[model samples]
Target chain A: MTAKLAERPAGADLVRSGIRAQAANSSFAFVVRAAAVSVFVILVLIVVTMTREAWPAFWHSGLGFVTGTDWSPSADLYGALPFVYGTMVSSLMALVLALPVSIGIALFINEYAPRRLRAPGVYLVDLLAAIPSVVYGLWGVLVLGPFLLPYVQKVADTIGTWPVFSAVFGGPVGLKSMFLAALILTIMIVPIITSITREVFDTVPADQKAAAVALGATRWEMVRGAVFPHSRNGMVAAVLLGLGRAMGETIAVALVIGSTAQITTRIFAPADSMAAVIANTFGESSGVNRAALIGLGVVLFAMTIVVNMAGQFVARRSGRKGAGT
Target chain B: MTVPAALHVPPTEAPPTALATEGLGVYYGDWLAVDDITLQVPRHHITAFIGPSGCGKSTLLRCFNRMNDLIAGARVVGRVTYGDVDLYDDRIDPVQVRRRIGMVFQRPNPFPKSVYDNVAYGLRVHAMTEDLDDRVEDALRRAALWDDVKGALKKSALALSGGQQQRLCIARTIAVEPDIVLMDEPCSALDPIATGRIEDLMQELRRDYTILIVTHNMQQAARASDYAAFLTTEVDGDGDRRRGKLVEFAATNELFTHPQDPRTENYITGRFG
Candidate 1:
């Protein structure tokens, strides 16, 4: 049939080649579509399996799982409030501690760093990201906790007088506490946020930067007028990415967070995160307790999804303004 | 209509030179891009630099406002003077030099901000905030963009058509009320009709501001300038190093009709660049 098509007139040659091309294209597309669909299938399967395993705990606990703090397996009491509190507070604490420093480092690497230092600065930031989270946990336990104790105590002494600060920083500052976990999380997430922010700042149009300078804007003002506004969406997305990482982190947080089932106003107090509690106790847990741990994973997944949706919303809003020369 | 008095300076009594360079050369790291040349830009007149690609016309234009200082490894030798002040003096700030001499780039680069904010950016930067709305209005009117964009002042500057965006850039440049406006191929990215509008705007602008423009289009240099400078690239025998050298500096009509330099005549008559 191939030899006959080649022997045929030019019209048949065109039709034959067209059919052959179409066949190749459809086969390629079919392979690609299958690969793409597998990801969705795996995701759906995970969700279904988790939902099935978690349903019993959900039915037994009702709203109590969210608001209750007790986690005594012997008493058959399972509440998730302390873990939720730890996760939320530690993540927020990390964000608060890391946001300004990350932005400053990003700006320095992009705009203000001396020419010779820029490359090394970026490399050092990447090096920070490459360090294993377990190493960070070890450093938090051995080096950082000892090194920072005196300063943390000083801060606790100075600002502990204020009502708001007292509530957050009051109580015994310990080696393993919500504050320590948040500090460790800051170390882990800063590089992620800074690298993304630097890349976004780099994407600001060169002509726009020149425009601001040509209009007599000072360096800081030029960054404000051009770089920051242009990169705002990407910056938000970067911060949210860091937030997601901080929320899902397991081993480092488990080691530092002290894993307790009490909710307290003091951030210096020991607390438990959902991932930490699951990792620490899941091996020994059975029956409804294991199911409740799986349910906690579901909640963490939902929170990350909400964060990602907010990031997408911000990205789309700024995307409209991205249509520039 | 009044800027805060402390931040405003009355234009100096018509100095013979708005900006002038003596023995000026620019280098990017090891490469010498433009060689020593002296030229004077008369106040309130249009001086156009015409050259082919890689001829360093834009480099020379950037010298007026110290804009070349922004580029890494860029070095300017010799002196550039804005009236009596040497622009490269250690006491002089490039930011201040930029304020006195504004620039418009080849592409339309409005901030990702509202049209009003784009025009107001320079004002707010220099702290010339009093009656800022009137200043923005005056600038837009002067650039002949007010009517087209007045209704959409709050709209993002990036939302405008290319021509409108370019005009908005012009308004932003002029809003600072600089003494000299350096345009580096401002109309290169525009259609002929848009180019024509900019040419008309340039003529109107020249009545008040000293305008120095670098353009690749010979006709644009001839049609829109009072004086023209022609530059061409000189390659070494090894072809390793190329530098842009000025061939002719004369009144537009004289340079075009009469051949002071054979190279200028060839370039003007389409024989070579």
Candidate 2:
């Protein structure tokens, strides 16, 4: 009927206007699809690049790259043990220190914080995340380093007899160590964890809270029994995402870490991580040294992919199960 | 409908007992939702608070347990006395008040736990018992859900049907052993079968607890509540939306048979909201 009417002279304008409206909607849909594709492509490209570099360490070095501990690039002896230990220890430190603070901050924003304060609290947390990696490094060097030194030195001197402390607390506070890197990483990742956790916590339905409240559960009880349990998987994912951030950080770790290739966790002792090693050595070294560091980069790159893939795999599987249920 | 010729005298004059509101008012920021409602939710019976949408029936229920305080701007005024204690007293805690006066919301929001866990949630919240298993079993039995859900006590509460879920919520509330249970449109989203089950459950449970239910269904109000408070709101003489008067409160049989107020008649007859 529309085709028959459009054939007539009188129907030409209406058909043209209808076509224009349809075209507008069609264009809007096309833009949305294009944006989605771009995001997908960017993610795929990052994965491909990381894997392309990573495949060498996995293919050539194989189990040795993962299992071996010594890392000496000076005379062509390269083992990933210390960097792996440093990465694990630092990330673990970051997570343990940041987890409670991040969760607390998220809860405050989601529940206890006043209505007027909620949005601003969120903004402040985001601003923490927005600060550049170099600024964090500079801030640690100029401010946090001196502040942490005295207490760290005292603790190291006090606990030097303990096995763990004996290994880590040998140096004074100014020297780079796993603890300092971990502390810096903790401060860096708190905002990221809090922001993501807060978002996920916010998505928990109001009705659920109200229901728990009606059941005579206190605010803390409601969070513990309902909100936390419901959003636990997402919260874990948020923490893992923060761990990923802590592992990959370069300038901040480089600035405070004393840049020694050792697995020592002493807060006062100097030590280095994979990212810190690569950052400090990249510009100065050449030939096999750079390739070894590149090889370490290959290792670091591989480790993060596995970590993030594990994180996102858990996130997606849980998301699918949650959505299905 | 007029006050019956035989039952001509007022009803609330029995005594100043049960629930009494003295010059009560409520505010949220600059907005006043409840305008000085002085009422006595009768003891040993169900009281229905029936009003149009946003007439503050639900708001009034929240006030009893200080649930309104959860809202950032909400404030309570005047006095609400339960037995001898003033609920709004400066030293009083909302948690204590809420524990005594449990509430069930419109939607059935069971905690995403096993049926047993959902029932035991309140007991654990109140820290009333260390042995939660027996307590959970007893509460479910009281809510008339023990038989149906008994076999699969380990099943998630979400697996229950909408009606069963609501009853599970009731079981959850009752587990804490509150004196008064306030239900905010508890059956609005339920099917007739579910609604009937809840209505019957209320009748069986009312011997030990006072219940206040806010309902949209007039028939439900007539069926469930022994005493009814018909609330209404209108653009008042001050040109602001003033909460309508309490109109009247009476025995269920008398209120429905011969309602004294024209507004009640119109509302009951479906002539207008």
Candidate 3:
């Protein structure tokens, strides 16, 4: 067998096969490289084309396009501040509302749940993410909005009595309101955040967890000592992804956000976000109006990019400080 | 010749028992990992459990601090006692049990925290924060890691070398001033020089703390421990399942030199695992 193996390939034959293998390897490398570069190419194309389409509105309104409040297309007025305000308020509120609940659910599943219940709990939370955003909009309009109206009004009446608190809470409660839209956005983003946090929690080394327990830590203490510091960056990323999801949500916000181009401190008041405004007016919009809608899209894109970059910076900095290299 | 001269000289008197287990059988689901283990661990002495892989030596070591309680579906059907307290009593908190009986893992499992934090973790958790700096320093000093790490207390524990990390883990475990320290193959992941350092440290630590260690290295068990238990796997009836059984427990020198059981003799002679 040794003699046969040694004679299987002569030097000349080995050289030919090596040449063929090298050719195949380079071709495979070329294919994968092309596939990888295509994503960047597509991203650049989208940015260039979108910027070109929105140029007219940028030229027309200049700085006022972002900082000014009015957004009346018929009067040839288009200030994006109202939509920007609505988007920021709704998305940030959603993030604040969803974060704790998502972390709680993740911890419950990963650390506290019984072995039999853990799998089902994860599946159920993931199932929430699988639901269509339109369904969430429908639920917000038909069920959640009406259900929350009384509580929201009670807050407006009670908390609104304080001069400082009255600014954000004092307003007539409506079926289609910023608060209702934000509540729906909260529900929409929770599953994504929870799933990501769960994955991060899983990445914590088992031995590290064992070390904590061996040191006489209670269950919660172990999580705080070992799991939290280890998964800090990942949890930050999860929250940021949820924020991005809440910000770009169109149909859900459009349906429940009251579609009004106005900025108000009262969350119970009707308002419009950037994506909602674009979706609600895009059908009949033409000329400068269409350019203005696309301009809103450009602004939304920039905001998300900035938010993601900020999240990355926070994640990296905290990871270094907390994780200790 | 590497065996210390003191190790060959048996103690003049019997030491008091610090911990004891009776009819101990550990199970994961239905599979019994270790069965009928009854032994008394002497106070302030290093007792080593020597066995091959799958011999449940590590499982038995975990039972000391109730670290097995963390594993899902893992059950202990026996009595483990520290002093007069039944460790498995319903009212006894596993967390508090762990505070009194600490553990070091096979791999050096230091928290992803600064060296200062890693040593202070157990103290902080148990609300023993008074003179925290002194306690951390003392623990590091006891683990023989103070000189190497004192300059880098704020540095991440992970930045240390493998031996330093293991010593740091030792410092973390002893920081709470646990009465007993359980080591599960603490030197298995280390190199020879690091292993020798740990073995020397173990000898120093045995002066104050009761220690139970599970080790695959026979020479380490012989050189470092005062008492030794030799365990081996036995095939269960009507199945291919192998369950760990203790064949002999005796003074370390006696067990290595004149093993009572044929199985122990076989294992010590390198005849079979």
List clash counts for every candidate, in order: 0, 4, 0
Q: Per-residue lDDT for A168-188 in model 3, tens only?
A: 888677889999899999999
How high is the lDDT of residue A140 in model 2? 81
**Candidate 1 DockQ vs. native:** 0.49
Best by DockQ: 3
Return the TM-score for chain B, candidate 2. 0.91
lDDT of 2 by residue, A188-268 (tens): 999988987888788777877887887767899989878886777778788778888898999899898778776655656
- Residue A7 local lDDT, model 2: 81
Q: TM-score of each candidate?
A: 0.92, 0.89, 0.94
DockQ, candidate 2, vs. native dimer: 0.50
The residue pairs found clashing in candidate 1 are none
**Per-residue lDDT value at A317 in model 2:** 56
Q: Model 2: runs farther than 4 Å from truth?
A: A1-62, A162-174, A316-325, B1-16
Clash pairs, model 2 backbone: A69-A81, A168-A266, A176-A258, A176-A270
| lDDT by residue (tens digit), candidate 3, B39-109 | 98889999999988899999999888898898888999889989888899999999999999999999998
CA shift at A1, candidate 3, in angstroms? 6.2
Clashing pairs in 3: none
Write down the C-alpha DockQ for each prediction: 0.49, 0.50, 0.74
lDDT of 3 at A246: 92
Cα lDDT tens digits, model 1, B137-165, are 99999999999988999888878888889
Error of 1 at A208 (Å): 0.2
* Candidate 1 stretches greater than 4 Å from native: A1-31, A312-325, B1-15, B237-240
